[model samples]
Target: MADDSKSGGDLEKDQRSQEDAPPSSIYLISYPKIVFLYPTFLVAVVVAIFMSIAGESAQIGGNREHMAEVMSLIFLGVFGLNLTVLAFDFPRTTSLTLFFLGAALFMGAWMLLRFNPDIVPTITGLLKGLRPWANSQMYWLFASILGLIFIGVAISVRFDYWEVKGNELLHHHGFLSDLERFAAPNLKIDKEISDIFEYLLLRSGRLVLHPRNQPRAIVLDNVPFISRKEKQITRMLGALQVQVRPDNH
Candidate 1:
């Protein structure tokens, strides 16, 4: 009876300690700075809005000539937004950004050729001075789609949060009430530095963890500053054993 009571008390104490532990400090392994990118994007948005208004006025006035300028401005705005996403460290962001950038460049080239036939002498000579009217509707349509994609990516990244606590890793993704937890206790962690560009740019690091009784390993890629993360994981694991650098490896 006495032994049972003593075991119960110890279990309660352990539970209390775990419950009382402080929350982990979340770290963004890699996030791009908004300072430089935001300004350029803002400028592009302003230009687009101005061009949109001007184009509408021109259409109302029956001029219809200023429509090309409006399309160019809208393209510029999309290009700027794409640049901003590229500035962010998101991998998929770059692909989408590049796609939009390429589309904008293609459209811009077409618009230039359409408005200024003399600029492309070969095409002008071949076509015999055929001019294409600017498609104002398509200009705003593509811009709106690109803008929505940009906003979606931004929101997704902003809401995703990841952190490491003592012997545990937590990820909170999505808008609200969505959480995922992963925990490993005093497990062996190995880090490998690969990629020549990663070494030069100092932006890539890999974390490999071998957990007990787990057939598969946990691998984290594109982690920044390996040494610091190694130390953090080391300290957290060491705390479990009440000793640093266990000889067992």
Candidate 2:
């Protein structure tokens, strides 16, 4: 009797523990492509800090001036590259590779011309005019504005997001906490990494969810850490299926 009672107590404790455990679910939040500009934002912040330090130092003539010019050039290059990426979609890795190759060839040609100034005196004069120059204060102002914009983006996303649970898919939206639920029993999910560059930036991709009885799939784009979320949803649904499967007679 005592052994049976102890076993019963152990079973009760196991059930209670299971009840207390957090749900195994994934929250899917889609972000805008501007979020990927974080690389440029980070670079700006770093440049601001470096320039501030350089400005404070006693040695502020030849080397300091050169370093500031280099920093400004780097900042402009990154900003231009970021804008170029935003303007176009590199859907395939081949396209991305081609872009890099083209950029490299252009840079190589420019460098060759720069070194052999006699060949194209006009080229050196044009390059001198193209040099981007900015002070430490300018860098700080740019970083501050970008940082605030990022914060706004973060806050705006909270109003609309999706949650995937063991037995259902949920869309939670609106300022008033509106939620729409769909059955997950026969849910179909497709993961598409459409843009190679975007994926490289944030491991982001599109998730197409085909919920049971729905005529159209719910397409969510710019989802960060997409692979992990897909695996998690798969595991949750697989486990749910196993739990509900009928035994052979």
Candidate 3:
């Protein structure tokens, strides 16, 4: 019974020790802007599947034609919107909201006008003729290209990333795995979300790291989950600071 009690006490102590242990390291990866085109890539795949199914069925001519037209419009709209997002920056949530609201209002008006052909026959005629239909193969090709790009982006980021340890910051880059180290003690970090759209897409932002004795701050952009990363870094450095502080009598 004494042996059993001693074993239980030892197990409890081990668990406590493990629970108090700090993280070994935190890795930060910054993705390129092209990652935002995931929406277009996904839409292309979906549209390709739909087109493939429609092409297989020879009996439903009218329905297939209607679906093709609708899908074409949807693809064009998504592509245009994605391009616009890539071209412009929405720095604030208010501006992003207003942009979306205005787009919705414009689409609603266009839809109303489209349904009521008699309102403006000339515009209705032009809209009716604007069926931007394409073969399933085209969509598949588009999806394939985007898929390859995404894969490349994923692989490329692995070669260029930052690692934060309790005592040092590391930059691991290049195909040969070149590493650069910086003092992490007393490191200053700042988080900035410059674009709301990018943030909404991936919870991404910029992380500025000021290492001790460094003249310039290291700026990492498009870092996903910026807030969580900042907190973990703070916790790691805070614990280090507490451990290294001199005890006063």
Candidate 4:
């Protein structure tokens, strides 16, 4: 009788413990949030393209034009140097790279002009583009498009985000608070080095989850501090598994 009573008491304790187990933490993960850079990059591309065109053809009034290959060379050099940026991972802002690149270009130009005085006329002509020119409103068009994209991305970022609960993965998106949930148990996580350049910039990477029941995987791109987040998810889920398991007794 005593044994039976003791067993009953133990059973009650276990039930209460299981019932009172706190919910596993909900982990919120978000993108690196560098969407504003899109406009900056677009502006750079436009400037580079225009610089090349300016070098190829000097424009005056509506119809006056002449060849100017010096501008083209500088444009090519700038574009080529920028491409090397892709070869290494860069940080969140490109200020350092841009600074270094500008310094290098300045030195190169100084050296060229110092050694070859004859090239001053060509360089002077290229410098002329910096002054006001006809058809200058084209720059305003680029600026407007850049502003629209900057505003659109800034607004969308607030609504679009990902989260991980012990049992499910959740995507909160759209202005309407639309939520999509996916089973997370037995969920396989993968971290991919999507772009070395991006990784170098912000230590960002693509994090993907394969749900046991879902045929397609959900992918989250440009997750900053990916390594830390991965460890956190693994630890959180492990604790959740322990909490949910039935007592062997």
Candidate 3 residues lying further than 4 Å off, grouped into runs, are 1-22, 56-64
Q: Which stretches of candidate 2 lie over 4 Å from their true place?
A: 1-23, 56-65
Candidate achieving the largest lDDT = 3
| lDDT of candidate 4 over 26-112, digit per residue (tens) | 444455344424434554456546655664346545536432334334434544554555444554466467668989999999888
Task: Kindly give the stretch of ten consecutive residues in candidate 4 with the minimal lDDT sum.
Answer: 131-140
CA-lDDT, candidates in order: 0.59, 0.85, 0.88, 0.64
Better of 1 and 3 by TM-score: 3
The digit string of per-residue lDDT tens for model 1 on 28-79 reads: 3533333224334444455556556666435423644455554455556656
* TM-score leader: 3
Number of clashes found in candidate 1: 0
Give each model a TM-score: 0.38, 0.84, 0.85, 0.50
Error of 2 at 173 (Å): 0.8
lDDT, candidate 2, at 93: 53
What is the model-wide C-alpha lDDT for candidate 3?
A: 0.88
Compared with the true structure, what per-residue lDDT tens digits does model 3 show for residues 112-227?
88678789888878877786667788899999999999999999999999999869999999999999999999999999988888888889999999999999999999899998
As for candidate 4, its clashing pairs are: 89-200, 90-200, 90-201, 91-201
lDDT of 2 at 57: 32
Clashing pairs in 3: none
